[model samples]
Target: MGQGETEKIAGELIRQAVMLLMDRNEDITLSSVLNILADFQMRAFNTGQLNACIQAIADVSAAKSGSLREESALKDKVAGKCSSCRSSDNVTTLH
Candidate 1:
């Protein structure tokens, strides 16, 4: 199957797994969840199938930034402070 199709399937599987865990009042760690998905993939699909699904789910849930403006701003602020002294020297000015 195509990458998109694989990702779609993986995403659905992850969603189902999440719902199942939630329904059972179970708290699953990332590793455990991945193991469960891997098992499901091994039995139901081919290699890399489960990984693709998980990636798809992550892609959907993860935040998307159109630009690095926020990151840059934070960096600018941090750049003003010295790592050792925490001093804002003239050369370390933010602006």
Candidate 2:
């Protein structure tokens, strides 16, 4: 298609995506819209913008997921430990 035709189609897609998110009570931020468009592109074109940045996005997501997992595990390990169990008298702070 011509550039103009492609742009018009993209504009309509954006409007539809935004309205769909609004209807679903989803957040309407740039990231939300872009994510929707990314999914649509995957469905319609089988690929697009993500081709350029997929590796970077994957790296970031994986790193954050690992960090969150570690944080959760640490919380689980540290929980239920009350330093205020006392030395038979006063309380102790867990620093």
Candidate 3:
């Protein structure tokens, strides 16, 4: 395939992967998401192409780190709180 074809395929794969993650409400971890993208790339293109696609995805998603951190913190806070405890003094925050 030509460079244009390779890039097209890679873009489609990345799009599908992103949509899957969004549908599942999955955390956008680069390593984990790259694994999925790499699998598709390996089948659709060369290893080099796979690496390039992953890099592109990482670049686009890098700004989302702060949002992910906030979401994780909220989840942790919810999980750590006890429903039976009403007073802050009776509840201990887990670090």
Candidate 4:
């Protein structure tokens, strides 16, 4: 899929996910995300849409003018940050 189409799908997914979350009584959960992804996926055996969604996320993260870039900068500017993010960065995948 083209970048534009990917972006549109991403936007729609985000909108739906936020609504899904708001309808829930819990603090946070990935169930909504999973539900939305299940719909976006192609055949049960094909992960093409999921992979495209990942690429779409990376594209937005790499953009110079997006909220992600702004969030990154804000994260760096904060002092005495928690270790959750740092710990996540330290994760090592066994090959």
Candidate 5:
């Protein structure tokens, strides 16, 4: 894929991950980011694409987690749903 296409894919993956967190009323934290990244790693993404996707996720995750409160509470919430969490399948690819 071209650079633009890779960027688009990364953006979509980030959106899907964010939507999943939002739908579950969860804040985006480091654990959330790791969970989302784990889901993506289960797919057949190329190295460059995966790197881009990870970077995109990290960027958005940092922004979202900026106002995190009560580290212990966040940890509990993250641990609760992380075991069965999966990234959304709302991906869009160039044909």
Candidate 6:
């Protein structure tokens, strides 16, 4: 799947999970979200979608555990900006 598609699926899964867990009076941790996604994987979601969803959850969890500023920075990264510098104009490639 393309990066944009992956991000969209991941974002949707994360958003809904937060809502569902809130309705159930449960905490919406990364693991909880991942389990929800995993259950969906067995029935409907494909492997690629599941993987992307899990990755996105992990990223959010990691950022949350760190500084609050990192959360905004991580969001920028989600938007395809460089995590270190938050720039999309300059391209960096490694071989």
Evaluated with TM-score, which candidate comes out highest? Answer: 6
**Model 1, C-alpha of 77: deviation from truth (Å):** 15
lDDT of residue 89 for candidate 3:
55
Q: Stretches of candidate 3 above 4 Å error? A: 41-95
Which pairs clash (backbone N, Cα, C closer than 3 Å) in model 3?
none
lDDT of 3 by residue, 3-32 (tens): 666567556766777777888899756655
**Backbone clashes in model 4, listed as residue pairs:** none
Local accuracy of candidate 5 as per-residue lDDT tens digits, 1-95: 57777678777777777688889999976578557766885773578767767667676667556646445445644555332244323222211
The candidate 5 region of ten consecutive residues with least summed lDDT is 86-95
- lDDT on C-alpha atoms for all candidate structures: 0.61, 0.58, 0.64, 0.52, 0.64, 0.67
For candidate 6, the lDDT comes to: 0.67
Number of the predicted model whose lDDT against the real structure is largest: 6
| Shift of residue 91 alpha carbon in model 5, Å | 50
By lDDT, the candidates rank as 6, 5, 3, 1, 2, 4
**What TM value does model 1 have?**
0.45
The better candidate by lDDT, 1 or 5, is 5
Clashes of each: 2, 0, 0, 0, 0, 0
Instruction: Give the least accurate 10-residue stretch of model 4, judged by summed lDDT.
Output: 86-95
Residue-by-residue lDDT tens digits, candidate 1, 19-54 = 777788888645446655656656655556656755
For residues 18-83, write the lDDT of model 4, one tens digit per residue: 576678854433444545445555422435456655644454344524656666655654533433
Ranking by TM-score: 6, 2, 5, 1, 3, 4
